[model samples]
Target: MSSQPAIIVSSLDMDRIEALIEKMPRLTPEVEQLENELDRATIVAPEAIPANVVTMNSTVRFKFIGDDKVFEKTLVYPHDLKHDEQVSIFAPVGSALLGLAVGQSLNWPMPNSQSRTVEILEVLYQPERAGEYLR
Candidate 1:
Protein backbone atom coordinates (compact mmCIF):
# COMPACT_ATOMS: atom_id res chain seq x y z
CA MET A 1 0.00 0.00 0.00
CA SER A 2 1.02 3.64 -0.43
CA SER A 3 2.81 4.98 2.60
CA GLN A 4 1.18 8.36 2.24
CA PRO A 5 -0.75 8.48 5.48
CA ALA A 6 -3.20 11.28 4.95
CA ILE A 7 -1.58 14.71 4.87
CA ILE A 8 -1.69 15.63 8.51
CA VAL A 9 -0.95 19.32 8.76
CA SER A 10 1.22 20.35 11.64
CA SER A 11 -0.27 22.85 14.07
CA LEU A 12 2.53 25.28 13.35
CA ASP A 13 1.54 25.19 9.70
CA MET A 14 -2.17 25.38 10.47
CA ASP A 15 -2.15 28.57 12.53
CA ARG A 16 -2.79 30.60 9.42
CA ILE A 17 -4.95 27.94 7.82
CA GLU A 18 -7.27 27.91 10.84
CA ALA A 19 -7.66 31.66 10.75
CA LEU A 20 -8.36 31.60 7.04
CA ILE A 21 -11.01 28.91 7.48
CA GLU A 22 -12.72 31.02 10.08
CA LYS A 23 -12.80 34.03 7.84
CA MET A 24 -13.90 32.18 4.72
CA PRO A 25 -17.24 30.71 5.68
CA ARG A 26 -18.08 30.08 2.06
CA LEU A 27 -15.82 27.04 1.86
CA THR A 28 -17.40 23.92 0.46
CA PRO A 29 -18.38 20.91 2.57
CA GLU A 30 -15.26 18.95 1.71
CA VAL A 31 -13.00 21.87 2.53
CA GLU A 32 -14.82 22.49 5.79
CA GLN A 33 -14.61 18.78 6.58
CA LEU A 34 -10.87 18.95 6.07
CA GLU A 35 -10.68 21.74 8.60
CA ASN A 36 -12.70 19.66 11.03
CA GLU A 37 -10.50 16.65 10.38
CA LEU A 38 -7.45 18.74 11.14
CA ASP A 39 -9.07 20.07 14.27
CA ARG A 40 -9.95 16.59 15.47
CA ALA A 41 -6.53 15.17 14.75
CA THR A 42 -4.22 15.64 17.69
CA ILE A 43 -1.03 17.25 16.53
CA VAL A 44 2.03 15.47 17.78
CA ALA A 45 3.93 17.99 19.86
CA PRO A 46 7.42 18.94 18.81
CA GLU A 47 9.52 16.41 20.66
CA ALA A 48 12.68 14.48 19.99
CA ILE A 49 11.50 11.75 17.68
CA PRO A 50 13.71 8.70 17.23
CA ALA A 51 13.88 9.19 13.47
CA ASN A 52 16.31 11.45 11.71
CA VAL A 53 15.28 14.78 10.29
CA VAL A 54 16.67 16.58 7.27
CA THR A 55 18.73 19.58 8.22
CA MET A 56 21.24 21.95 6.84
CA ASN A 57 24.31 20.08 5.58
CA SER A 58 22.67 16.68 6.08
CA THR A 59 23.28 14.04 3.42
CA VAL A 60 20.25 12.28 1.96
CA ARG A 61 19.20 9.85 -0.77
CA PHE A 62 16.19 10.79 -2.90
CA LYS A 63 14.63 9.84 -6.26
CA PHE A 64 12.57 11.76 -8.76
CA ILE A 65 10.44 10.93 -11.82
CA GLY A 66 12.91 11.70 -14.61
CA ASP A 67 16.17 10.71 -12.97
CA ASP A 68 17.07 7.01 -12.90
CA LYS A 69 19.84 7.61 -10.47
CA VAL A 70 19.31 7.77 -6.71
CA PHE A 71 20.88 11.17 -6.10
CA GLU A 72 23.04 11.58 -3.04
CA LYS A 73 23.11 15.24 -2.15
CA THR A 74 23.74 17.25 0.97
CA LEU A 75 20.51 18.84 2.10
CA VAL A 76 20.28 22.52 2.95
CA TYR A 77 17.38 23.01 5.25
CA PRO A 78 15.19 26.11 5.62
CA HIS A 79 16.75 27.18 2.33
CA ASP A 80 18.87 26.19 -0.67
CA LEU A 81 16.47 23.76 -2.37
CA LYS A 82 16.37 23.38 -6.11
CA HIS A 83 13.09 23.00 -8.02
CA ASP A 84 13.24 19.22 -7.65
CA GLU A 85 15.12 18.76 -4.37
CA GLN A 86 14.27 21.71 -2.17
CA VAL A 87 10.64 21.77 -1.10
CA SER A 88 9.00 24.41 1.05
CA ILE A 89 6.17 23.77 3.54
CA PHE A 90 3.81 25.90 1.52
CA ALA A 91 4.72 24.11 -1.71
CA PRO A 92 2.92 20.93 -2.74
CA VAL A 93 6.02 18.74 -2.74
CA GLY A 94 7.32 20.40 0.37
CA SER A 95 4.13 19.71 2.29
CA ALA A 96 4.33 16.07 1.27
CA LEU A 97 7.97 15.64 2.19
CA LEU A 98 8.31 17.19 5.64
CA GLY A 99 8.66 14.77 8.59
CA LEU A 100 9.41 11.61 6.65
CA ALA A 101 11.47 8.76 8.10
CA VAL A 102 14.12 6.64 6.42
CA GLY A 103 12.90 3.51 4.52
CA GLN A 104 9.49 5.13 4.28
CA SER A 105 8.04 5.51 0.81
CA LEU A 106 5.19 7.75 -0.28
CA ASN A 107 3.41 8.30 -3.52
CA TRP A 108 2.36 11.91 -4.06
CA PRO A 109 0.10 13.15 -6.81
CA MET A 110 1.05 16.07 -9.01
CA PRO A 111 -1.21 18.60 -10.61
CA ASN A 112 -1.28 16.45 -13.68
CA SER A 113 -1.92 12.70 -13.72
CA GLN A 114 1.74 12.15 -12.94
CA SER A 115 2.83 10.82 -9.56
CA ARG A 116 6.15 11.01 -7.74
CA THR A 117 7.63 8.34 -5.51
CA VAL A 118 9.98 9.31 -2.67
CA GLU A 119 12.00 7.24 -0.27
CA ILE A 120 14.33 8.25 2.54
CA LEU A 121 17.61 6.38 2.75
CA GLU A 122 19.67 8.37 5.20
CA VAL A 123 19.16 11.40 7.36
CA LEU A 124 22.63 12.75 8.04
CA TYR A 125 21.48 15.11 10.81
CA GLN A 126 18.70 17.08 12.35
CA PRO A 127 18.68 20.83 12.31
CA GLU A 128 16.24 21.04 15.18
CA ARG A 129 17.45 19.89 18.57
CA ALA A 130 13.89 19.45 19.85
CA GLY A 131 10.54 18.63 18.22
CA GLU A 132 8.77 15.63 16.75
CA TYR A 133 10.59 16.10 13.47
CA LEU A 134 13.95 15.91 15.25
CA ARG A 135 15.81 13.14 17.00
Candidate 2:
Protein backbone atom coordinates (compact mmCIF):
# COMPACT_ATOMS: atom_id res chain seq x y z
CA MET A 1 0.00 0.00 0.00
CA SER A 2 2.92 2.28 0.75
CA SER A 3 6.23 2.42 -1.02
CA GLN A 4 7.43 -1.14 -0.75
CA PRO A 5 10.76 -2.13 0.66
CA ALA A 6 13.14 -3.64 -1.87
CA ILE A 7 12.90 -7.43 -2.16
CA ILE A 8 15.23 -10.16 -3.36
CA VAL A 9 14.07 -13.40 -4.93
CA SER A 10 16.11 -16.38 -6.06
CA SER A 11 16.16 -17.29 -9.74
CA LEU A 12 14.94 -20.81 -9.09
CA ASP A 13 12.01 -19.60 -7.06
CA MET A 14 11.23 -16.93 -9.62
CA ASP A 15 11.04 -19.50 -12.42
CA ARG A 16 8.82 -21.76 -10.38
CA ILE A 17 6.46 -18.98 -9.39
CA GLU A 18 6.19 -17.67 -12.91
CA ALA A 19 5.23 -21.14 -14.08
CA LEU A 20 2.67 -21.43 -11.35
CA ILE A 21 1.10 -18.12 -12.29
CA GLU A 22 0.85 -19.19 -15.89
CA LYS A 23 -1.04 -22.34 -14.89
CA MET A 24 -3.67 -20.51 -12.93
CA PRO A 25 -7.21 -20.82 -14.32
CA ARG A 26 -7.88 -17.11 -14.25
CA LEU A 27 -6.29 -13.86 -13.25
CA THR A 28 -7.20 -12.29 -9.93
CA PRO A 29 -6.11 -9.30 -7.92
CA GLU A 30 -3.90 -11.41 -5.73
CA VAL A 31 -2.25 -12.93 -8.76
CA GLU A 32 -1.72 -9.49 -10.25
CA GLN A 33 -0.22 -8.32 -6.99
CA LEU A 34 2.19 -11.24 -7.02
CA GLU A 35 3.11 -10.38 -10.56
CA ASN A 36 3.80 -6.81 -9.58
CA GLU A 37 6.07 -8.05 -6.83
CA LEU A 38 7.94 -10.30 -9.21
CA ASP A 39 8.34 -7.47 -11.69
CA ARG A 40 10.09 -5.31 -9.11
CA ALA A 41 12.16 -7.91 -7.30
CA THR A 42 15.89 -8.26 -7.44
CA ILE A 43 16.44 -11.78 -8.75
CA VAL A 44 19.63 -13.75 -8.23
CA ALA A 45 20.87 -17.32 -8.33
CA PRO A 46 19.44 -19.53 -5.62
CA GLU A 47 22.88 -20.01 -4.13
CA ALA A 48 23.32 -16.26 -3.89
CA ILE A 49 20.10 -15.39 -2.05
CA PRO A 50 20.73 -13.83 1.32
CA ALA A 51 20.11 -16.21 4.21
CA ASN A 52 17.57 -13.83 5.72
CA VAL A 53 15.44 -13.43 2.60
CA VAL A 54 12.18 -15.37 2.40
CA THR A 55 11.91 -17.68 -0.57
CA MET A 56 9.59 -20.48 -1.67
CA ASN A 57 9.43 -23.18 0.98
CA SER A 58 10.84 -20.91 3.62
CA THR A 59 9.48 -21.21 7.15
CA VAL A 60 9.05 -17.69 8.46
CA ARG A 61 8.00 -16.07 11.68
CA PHE A 62 6.10 -12.82 11.41
CA LYS A 63 3.41 -10.79 13.14
CA PHE A 64 0.98 -7.97 12.54
CA ILE A 65 2.44 -4.61 13.45
CA GLY A 66 0.05 -4.03 16.33
CA ASP A 67 -0.40 -7.62 17.32
CA ASP A 68 1.85 -9.26 19.84
CA LYS A 69 1.13 -12.81 18.72
CA VAL A 70 3.62 -14.07 16.19
CA PHE A 71 2.82 -16.55 13.45
CA GLU A 72 5.17 -19.14 12.02
CA LYS A 73 4.26 -20.62 8.69
CA THR A 74 5.81 -22.33 5.73
CA LEU A 75 5.39 -20.55 2.39
CA VAL A 76 4.20 -23.19 -0.04
CA TYR A 77 2.73 -23.51 -3.49
CA PRO A 78 -1.05 -23.98 -3.89
CA HIS A 79 -0.84 -27.76 -4.34
CA ASP A 80 1.51 -28.14 -1.39
CA LEU A 81 -0.91 -26.51 0.99
CA LYS A 82 -2.22 -29.29 3.21
CA HIS A 83 -1.73 -27.85 6.67
CA ASP A 84 -3.22 -24.77 8.28
CA GLU A 85 0.25 -23.37 8.83
CA GLN A 86 1.19 -23.54 5.17
CA VAL A 87 0.64 -20.37 3.11
CA SER A 88 0.10 -20.39 -0.61
CA ILE A 89 1.85 -17.71 -2.63
CA PHE A 90 -1.52 -16.83 -4.17
CA ALA A 91 -2.84 -15.78 -0.80
CA PRO A 92 -2.46 -12.11 0.03
CA VAL A 93 -0.36 -12.60 3.12
CA GLY A 94 1.76 -15.19 1.41
CA SER A 95 2.34 -12.97 -1.61
CA ALA A 96 3.27 -10.14 0.68
CA LEU A 97 5.83 -12.27 2.44
CA LEU A 98 7.72 -13.37 -0.64
CA GLY A 99 11.24 -12.00 -1.02
CA LEU A 100 10.94 -10.05 2.24
CA ALA A 101 13.94 -10.01 4.53
CA VAL A 102 13.82 -10.23 8.26
CA GLY A 103 12.88 -6.85 9.79
CA GLN A 104 11.01 -5.68 6.72
CA SER A 105 7.33 -4.81 7.08
CA LEU A 106 4.53 -4.46 4.57
CA ASN A 107 1.11 -2.87 4.70
CA TRP A 108 -1.17 -5.56 3.33
CA PRO A 109 -4.75 -4.86 2.33
CA MET A 110 -7.37 -7.17 3.74
CA PRO A 111 -10.54 -8.47 2.14
CA ASN A 112 -12.55 -6.21 4.44
CA SER A 113 -10.90 -3.07 3.06
CA GLN A 114 -8.73 -2.65 6.11
CA SER A 115 -4.95 -2.90 6.07
CA ARG A 116 -2.60 -4.74 8.35
CA THR A 117 1.11 -4.26 8.70
CA VAL A 118 3.05 -7.47 8.58
CA GLU A 119 6.56 -7.51 9.95
CA ILE A 120 9.01 -10.27 9.33
CA LEU A 121 10.51 -11.38 12.59
CA GLU A 122 12.69 -14.19 11.31
CA VAL A 123 13.27 -16.62 8.51
CA LEU A 124 13.58 -19.92 10.29
CA TYR A 125 14.27 -21.98 7.20
CA GLN A 126 14.94 -21.11 3.57
CA PRO A 127 15.42 -23.64 0.82
CA GLU A 128 18.23 -21.67 -0.80
CA ARG A 129 19.97 -21.11 2.50
CA ALA A 130 19.73 -24.83 3.23
CA GLY A 131 21.14 -25.72 -0.20
CA GLU A 132 17.85 -27.21 -1.34
CA TYR A 133 17.67 -25.03 -4.42
CA LEU A 134 15.52 -27.34 -6.49
CA ARG A 135 12.92 -27.79 -3.81
* Model 2 / residue 77 / CA error / Å: 0.4
Best by TM-score: 2
User: What ranges in model 2 sit over 4 Å off?
Assistant: none
Clash tally, candidates in order: 3, 0
TM-scores of the models, in the order given: 0.50, 0.95
lDDT of 1 at 21: 55
Cα lDDT tens digits, model 2, 53-102, are 99999999999998999999999999999998999989899998999999
RMSD of 1: 6.5
Off by over 4 Å in 1: 1-42, 53-60, 65-67, 71-85, 129-135
Error of 1 at 25 (Å): 13
lDDT, candidates in the order shown: 0.49, 0.91
Distance from true location, Cα of 33 in model 1, Å: 13
Q: How much does candidate 2 score in TM-score?
A: 0.95
